[model samples]
Target chain A: MRQDIIEIRWHGRGGQGAITAAKVVANAVFKAGYKGVVMAPTFGTERRGAPVFTSLKISREKIYDLSPIETPDMVVVLDHTLLEEVDVTHGLKDGGQIILNTPKAIDTYDFGAHKLSISDVTSHALEAGLAPGIVNTGIIGAFAKATGLVSRDLLREAILNEFSVMKPEENARAAALTYDRTVIGGA
Target chain B: MHVIESGNVAAATGVKLARTQVIAAYPITPQTPLTEKLSEFVESGDLPAEYIPVESEHSAMAVCIASSTAGARSFTATSANGLLYMNEQLHWAAGARLPIVMCVANRGVGAPWTVWNDHQDTVSQRDLGWIQLYCADHQQIHDTVLKAFKLAETVSIPVMVCYDGYLLSHTYMPFDVPEQEKVDAFLPGFEPTHFLNPEKPRNFNTVTLPDVRPDLHGNTAPGYMEIRKTLHTDLRAALSEIEKIDGEFGEIFGRGGEPFLEPYCCDDADYVAFCMGSLSYQLRDVVDAMREEGIKVGVMGLKVYRPFPDAAVREALSAFKGVIVLEKALSYGNQGALYADVKSALYSAETRPFVHNYIVGLGGREIKTQHLYDALTESINKEAAVGDEPRWIGLKL
Candidate 1:
């Protein structure tokens, strides 16, 4: 019911860009001159493919608590496999949104969320010759479309700043395509 | 400014003034107050530091060592089982030569779980290469902490400023908390004598051959020395540094003292009860009480433990007819640790008298004046019977 800054949770394998998404979100928010905190809960000598979560809280005021997010306004899944294995929707409040980077339709799985959506990011990533990990950028784009928590311009600025080594146009084009394919309403 | 505070609070105040950048701690009985005060400081923003709330003492020490290597002045306080749990990281902190300062509110390491004061916690860590300092009171507790940071950073060694649980850790006494500005002038920006900087990366603790290991170990190397010999030499040198630093500290912060060794009634006394930590305060009173009864009892408190002040011990105890080594911890293969060391120092002396090792207050057991008095009488009456062997006191099954 809060109409202020949105808190999002990212779910993915340790090597995936879930923590990067959270940090980018925080950097984007901080650049926008709002207070934000990005926290990642990593455990037990995490290896390349171990499950990990990164949480983000964007607020107008300073953030004090470092606890994991029990309830989130939005959830971004970098890997669809985590949905069945882990409770990705566990803390999503009513009217919250879920953005997935899978090629399938949103109705295929039973998920608890006010809005559910899937993007053709994997195919787009493979076709573009970018790594499979680039699906995170597509999901991030869909995140911006589903809930305007951050402006598209800010998201673009974050991606450019974070992925400075990569060609800026490649990530920006990926974000635009993801924004168009993402479904807005409940499944 | 001076205020009435417990020894635990005094150590916390020292940590605050020392401006420790990172503090990772989990609470244990006597050390709980120390971390609590630090938490309060972090909450009020009085100390601009990161206070990590760790789940266990092992993790607490791990985080502290990590933060210390990360170029942050780090600190933590723990007691008893907590210290034992952090045993692994304790060695790592020292071997890595990270200047991590820890306040070990000394309690008996246990399976029979006790919450009282003892030396067992620190006794277990004696071989871990940490420069350990024992404090007799609140003022010493404060001063020792300030000195620990300098000494640790100076020698690129970790230091544990230990005090008795419940006794000094909780007992209230007036102590002068040095002004932050003054302490800052004395101990500036912590330009570590050595550190882990990525700019010019150099591997620390690299493996060496038997040819070079002799030089690697002890009172020989510039900053590195043989582990055991360095522990001894650094501790002795620490006394002079303690005096010099305290003198500078007094000039800057307007507070100082003979922070290493405190002697009472030893000038003309025939017998002296040698102890450390807050128990020395009780022994001081006992010494006064016994003196009134014509016992000529003296008390010598070893404020610094690691540097086993051999010269100080021989000079102080050599003149006495009865020197009782009151220890709160036991040595597994031998007698009391400090007692054995003190006795060994007097081995070459011609005029040294009877030296008795008495192990009291294990598992946080309370060491009462009556218990101490009884132990003394037994030692005196037995004369030569109390020889070099250790005597265990107050173990009721």
Candidate 2:
């Protein structure tokens, strides 16, 4: 397949930092001298544990339309339970990749994608003494490995810009571990 | 200094400049970013305030009421369903007469839910006894927040600073955020004479006996009579305070649109259109085009919706042959509610013009300038038909 702009759809709960993940990705794209549209399609009252989806459209051109992406190029499931909550693979294009946050085997569920379970994301974060909320940074690292859409240097720069002020060294360690263990499943 | 900012950010900056001490809010569409930005200020140590992440909109208003009564400059914001959810405390905020400034990003209330710009949310709260100030642009959003605090505190009533949901909330424009020290000098910290302090405990909303009931109004009796008089008097008081606060704010902020009614091309016109909220800006554009074509039409925007600003409206509209009231909200029985009030204001004038009411947007429907232009074009033909009652623009069959 020809390499082009990568569109990512993030699925997770409200307080799971899904929105922040999209922003980090956008910031990464922006630092790469590209454009990224970070949009969160929120509904009803903001309740904890409610399923929330945020989208990031990273392109070399200016991103204008913010509507829901019918066919996302890459789908990052921040919460594994959201798979049963809605059809996560509804309009996912063929040859697209799915990055499940769980460690279970990809074929354990019938989700129709070349799936890889980045299960070590949480444990590695915990190993680094980073709390559970840093899974998003791990997801970014796995995303960079899976898609190769963004440079590791650019993603590292974006993560540092975002979280370096809060928890710097632990997140940098988490990003390094994530970049190493993210293995590609069957295509 | 002029900075490019979203309407939500602009309003938040206004609240920060006003030195709001407490912000209790639950996030809602078109309004979440306003509070989110304020929360950022609190987190970044830029603004020193209590940002309470409330459970629901009801609790949001409750927090605002309690905090404001305790001598704090409190603020909260919501849109659509969130405002409707805060229904009961809306009455409490007014009944207790707390001067809480709320920014209402006007949205459509739902059954079949929608998240778009409309006047349903703010318009439905017209009878809640709070002063309503509709804004036209980003500058007005900043001006209205500062003025609203003064008006609310002066009238001893709450005030709603309303703007179109997405039109103003999401759009970015150049905003002039005043210096904090200058704003502090303009609006000193509020110190309440009566607070829920442990040392000076007092009953807030207690039941009164019949004999003492009449004392609330003194000259006027109790029930609807006294309530109406109090509302009218308080609303009139709010209008004067609105003008006075605008003058002071103008001195500090250096931009002064009319604090009450903004008249556009009304001087030498035979016909005029009355609109509120962001539509007035759209109407002004139409008025300019019509003026260039020598249509002799003008635009009048109502900012203070409570006191009705009757005199200002009558003086500006009396010279026209007919007046067109473009309403986004409706009263089931009569004409557009504001049109009825405007008619009452114009009734005794010597040369009263004919009034036409065009109800265009209800459930967050898009209202184009052409729709307004079409309504005016129709009114020009049917001016004589409108005697006392007004006409609807795009009523559903």
Candidate 3:
């Protein structure tokens, strides 16, 4: 009963695709045979460049709570700069996980009592010719591999379902590259 | 027959399945997507309807009333001040008794200004005379709209399908989008009880003296008092009809339950939390956690807020040791509107438990489950007393 629901919160700028990514993850996870997946994109008054938060709840049982995620199991950030401005780790579980879009060494940052996973998500998305600031898919790939919340293949399908890429192979390669390059360890 | 989408799209899907012929819309906040999706359906030739893009919410509802008067199944969507802008016409539709269906993506009314979620906008218009139904999730949002059309047309009363602005409107979940044929079978075509037919011209509600009045044709019609009383009588009768329609809806769509009060885990509950819309979902989680901790607690969700389900409220709360009213809305000088009705419901009941109102999440402040958990624990341990003042739960004061 304790782990019946896994709540994930995404922190990104308003123009960023975290909101879409959250919905994609919800679609992906549900299609992958999970039950009662709920995704909520925060409808704040904030405009572009301002921080926006989105939440997802995956549960085998029907999820009743439709409120904001006060306590999330995992926190995913699209921009590494947001780590300083926003409380990226706010209200996360005791041993919760944090997946960040960064290329720095894991030991350089310290998030006590929570596990951390890192990838150069923005670089991968930019390298793949995906729109800048839309690093959600790249980090989502890092997220799937780091937490095993969803499979790598389904995440790619979800991404492809969302965007009809011109160089589609690079899109798949972007996810695979981020997935393979993700580093998981101490917070 | 199934789809994963936001609650707004679910409502639009219901509008499509109900075969709404005329849709009048002026986009507002969370409700914008609802009309947007319907417009897309019309533009895409998927939903065969005339989509009227109006300039304001007042005109939007006016257009709906006009369409319904012309004997067409009409639909519209609005929120917050947009709802308030249509205040006078809301009464007009009710008085005229047009079976127009509307989707109110409930949000906090503005002064300080907010685009976030709450129930204040819809609850404040309680006396505007509509069959108000609050939905708990995306699926219910879709289901209730279908039921709203059926219930509204059955009784010739307007119905508003309400849900928390962004909480349900923007949230995504898997829902069984009912078969179009099945919905078509369940909901019959719009048969207007009273309509404006140009062939038969007559003035409506122009004037009525205190006594019975005779028309040009020597037919007697009741006065204002009886007309007002009859509307309420028919509305009260609509409460029962809603249950019947719900049963028939279940037979066809297999998605029917109690259309009034939904009591959960309350056989021997020491406390039962009462709420409406998505907030109640959070309260349900708290109830389960409390139950797991050996505390007997449950939740009672309000499906139909209008016609005030007094008997059901009395029966549900009389068994619990205490009743906690969780409201995302307030009545200014008074407490939550639900708190007032709940207090009145228990006043005549044989048993009176401790009753309190936790006015949480007003103006879209985030209401976590722990805040509700703390409030419930406090209410259960306190006296079996009732008060006019509500404890402002989670307010920074």
Task: Using DockQ, give the best candidate's number.
Answer: 3
| Candidate 2 per-residue lDDT over residues B1-397, each given as its tens digit | 6554567888998998888899999999889889899999888878899999999999999999999888898999999899999999998888777899999998887877878777878888888888889987777898789888877877788999999776677654445677778787668778776778878787775654444254444664355445546766887777777888888877876778488888878888888889888777668757776777778898888888875788888887776898888887777677778888888989879899888888766765556555667778778677436554656555557
* Model 2 per-residue lDDT at B254: 73
Off by over 4 Å in 2: A1-187, B213-232, B383-397
DockQ agreement of candidate 1 with the native complex: 0.01
User: For model 3, how does the per-residue alpha-carbon lDDT over B1-397 read when each residue is reduced to its tens digit?
Assistant: 5567899999999999999999999989989889889999999999999999999999999999988988899999999999999999998898778889999999998898998888889999999778899988888899999999999898888999999898889988889887788989998889886678878875654777888888778999788778778778888889889889989988887776788877788888888899999887778888888898899998888999987878878987886778888898899987789999998988998888878788888878888788888888888877414566888777886
In terms of TM-score, the best-performing candidate is 3
Q: Which pairs of residues have clashing backbones in candidate 3?
A: A111-A187
Q: What does DockQ give for each predicted structure? A: 0.01, 0.03, 0.61
Compute the lDDT of residue B384 as modeled in candidate 3. Answer: 19
Residue pairs with colliding backbones in model 1 are: B217-B225, B217-B226, B218-B225, B218-B226
Q: What does candidate 2 score on TM?
A: 0.67
* Per-candidate fnat, comma-separated: 0.00, 0.00, 0.77
For A48-148, candidate 3 gives per-residue lDDT tens digits of: 88899999998887787777787899999999999889999999999999999986888888899999999999888888777665587788889889989
Per lDDT, the best of the predicted structures is: 3
Candidates ranked, most accurate by DockQ first: 3, 2, 1
Residue lDDT tens for model 2, A5-103: 466788878788776666666766666666423343443355788887766666675332333466787788876777889666667778777777766
